[model samples]
Target chain A: MRITQGAFSFLPDLTDEQISRQVQYCLGKGWAVNIEFTDDPHPRNNFWEMWGLPMFDLRDAAGVMMELNECRKVYGDRYIRMSAFDSSHGWESLRLSFIVNRPKDEPGFRLERHEVDGRNIRYTTTSYAVDRPEGQRYR
Target chain B: MDLDVVPMTGNVNLREELEAVGIEEILTQLDRELIGLKPVKTRIREIASLLLIERIRKRMGLTSEVPTLHMSFTGNPGTGKTTVALRIASILHRLGFVRRGQVVSVTRDELVGQYIGHTAPKTKEILKKAMGGVLFIDEAYYLHRPDNERDYGQEAIEILLQVMESQREDLVVILAGYGDRMEKFFGSNPGFRSRIAHHIDFPDYADDELLAIAELMLGDMNYRFSAAAREAFVRYITLRKAQPLFSNARSIRNALDRMRLRQASRLVADLDRVLSAEDIMSLEASDVLASRVFANGSSPANYG
Candidate 1:
């Protein structure tokens, strides 16, 4: 998967060794990680220049799932964010959905949307109870 | 394009040639070489190792692979920060981190073009030079401002952020400068801060370390120091040790060059004497006195 992830923090707060190890660890588990520049904020100062590399941007969704399985073996239950395409009518249109993995809820999280690529996207933004089908573990 | 397939079984020591050439020899020969910063070295090594692993796993069909990584270096002047960065580009190429590993270093002034609407192409031109390898920005702190500055360092920063994520598979970005100055630099722009996951620090060299480094410079040039000359050099260094502008290896070098010229002048009348290597190598009091080692402006900060 061509995976990308990003957020903000002063680059110096995290040593180069720490970040390289994390990138290595992520790659070792089958995730392609790119630490590139991003316009994120500093930890202490809300207004610092975005000087460091951002996060991972995954290209293929199904490929990401395979890697996510591998990731589970290493990261255990640690929260991971996933983005995948939702297509209809044989690739007529496509959009992406975001989800978090939980032990007891749905086997995986899926979001329904009017249009998958942009704003009309819906998500399970928080962890809460939902009604399940007859044999569902936790819907 | 590949019709013939061959089977391989043995491990090859890929860097035997580089190792044979000698790290010190290569360092000395380079147009610019910053010396002595172990922490920065170790960090670059870590990044190189990670890049190597990614390549191996991808070949075996076991990983999602990307081409290059983005990293930042933080340190003061004369800390050998830029020198290490260039070495990193070389090592990364050897290890297959980036395809070319050509390091294109620039400062904010080079990146942020003057006037409105001109900065994007300028930044892109720099990136073009840096394509297939590393783009190293010295004094990256200057790129971020409070939005009223005439320099388009911020616009360049934003455009760079988008390009970094888009073209990350082939390019690496390294932002470098003094530690405290960088903190203040980052404090000015939030958009420029978020993407960096790693930071490396280059600390200042100790006095004795700098002196030893100076001695090494002379040794490399096939010259040796006499007892008196060595003492005089050390005493001279001690006298200026507290000066805010004293250079590390570089200042010591300027001193030696001046001494060499002084010795040449003294030996002009004795050219027929057939001097031994020792006689020529051992620097004397006259050389030091005539040299500008005692000059007022012989410091690292004084140069650049």
Candidate 2:
């Protein structure tokens, strides 16, 4: 199954033009756009390795697209995502995020459940790919 | 098209679309932000109207005709070409013409390559990056070289032409350069010239306008010129205009930057005297006079 993790992941994989449009949308809203990638597809992995410095001073999507192209050249198999941060007082955090690239052969997550006292149960979600060492997990 | 609010009636509601997009607010902001460019602003308004009417016609079930938005911005440096291009991008986005209205600015070096078989990928990469927005090519004239047979700039141009025609809806390519050289470029390369629909020439700012720009810059930097210092700046403008390589408003900014440096040194020289807030903020006539342009000879001490 597809990870279905981001804004447009359910739809078709965005073409370069479509990705450029999304980047432009983020820049249009005056958000600080940044890119990240990781072989580990854990749901709680909030600190994926940043591709470059967060593009705060750029108003043009072309720069972000260029950097995205560069990042894809290296990390084509890893899951790469684009995120945007808004600096306004009320919304001083990430406003939008979308997975722009994904590795082939997505090893779906494994959900393990344990029955606790009084018929109560708890579940833990773990990524199958993480069985391999960190960097070698995806390929 | 963001025109869903407008009722789909037989008649066109031009005013509603204009208000919904807030084109007038962008135009007014353009006017207030830039110092003086009456004609440029008018042309932008005309383009906005053209796009607006095109949208209205489409809403009324007219033929779907996409007006090609490829344009040329010819002007001297520091004449607000980039600024105007950004505004045009915003306007294009607001009007629903382009998907994303950000400008990806590039120069000849960025597009053209040094050796054989390199220019195509470089140009294509840039085009991919600029997709769904404006691709602003500064000094676009440099892309054509009639004298050098081995030049790969023509390769870049050919690829650009193909994409400019094929991806007309997805991207807007804006060529910018000096007025005369751009004319020469258009003359030699008819294929390139024929693709451009709008040619906007940005004029050099007058001396008074440059002074106003300097004042505005100073204000933004939290510095103010003293009464006599303003008079000195007027003289400085006249002298700098006569000097070589004097870019209109850009040169004024450079001069003011140096003046600030001089003010810092002057303030530090008299360290014993307690400095007031006014002294920290105000630029004196001596600060303005200390430029290398004012001195008749290029002496080392006057460099301060």
lDDT of 2 by residue, B1-304 (tens): 2334343666656677789888889999999888987778889989989988887776776746677899999989889999999999999998887776768999999999888888976787678667668899999988998999779999999999987887677789999999999999999989888898999989889888898999999999999999999999999999888777778878788889999999999999998999889999999999999788888865533332
* Candidate 1 residue-wise lDDT, A1-139, digit = tens: 1112232122222333343334334433434332111122111222322112222332222222333444445443333433222223564321322222333322333344455676666543221222343223232
Instruction: Report lDDT (CA) for all predictions.
Output: 0.57, 0.85
Q: After superposition, how far is residue B155 of candidate 1 from its true place, in Å?
A: 1.9
Model 2 earns a TM-score of: 0.69
Q: Native-contact fraction for each model?
A: 0.00, 0.07
Q: Relative to the unseen true structure, what is the C-alpha lDDT of residue B44 in candidate 1, on a scale of 0 to 100?
A: 58
Question: Chain B TM-score of all predictions, in order?
Answer: 0.77, 0.94
Please give me the total number of clashing residue pairs in predicted model 2.
0
Report the C-alpha lDDT of model 1 over B78-167, residue by residue, as the tens digit: 667677778867766655556566788899887898988788767765775565678899988878776567557778988788767766
Among the numbered candidates, top lDDT falls to: 2
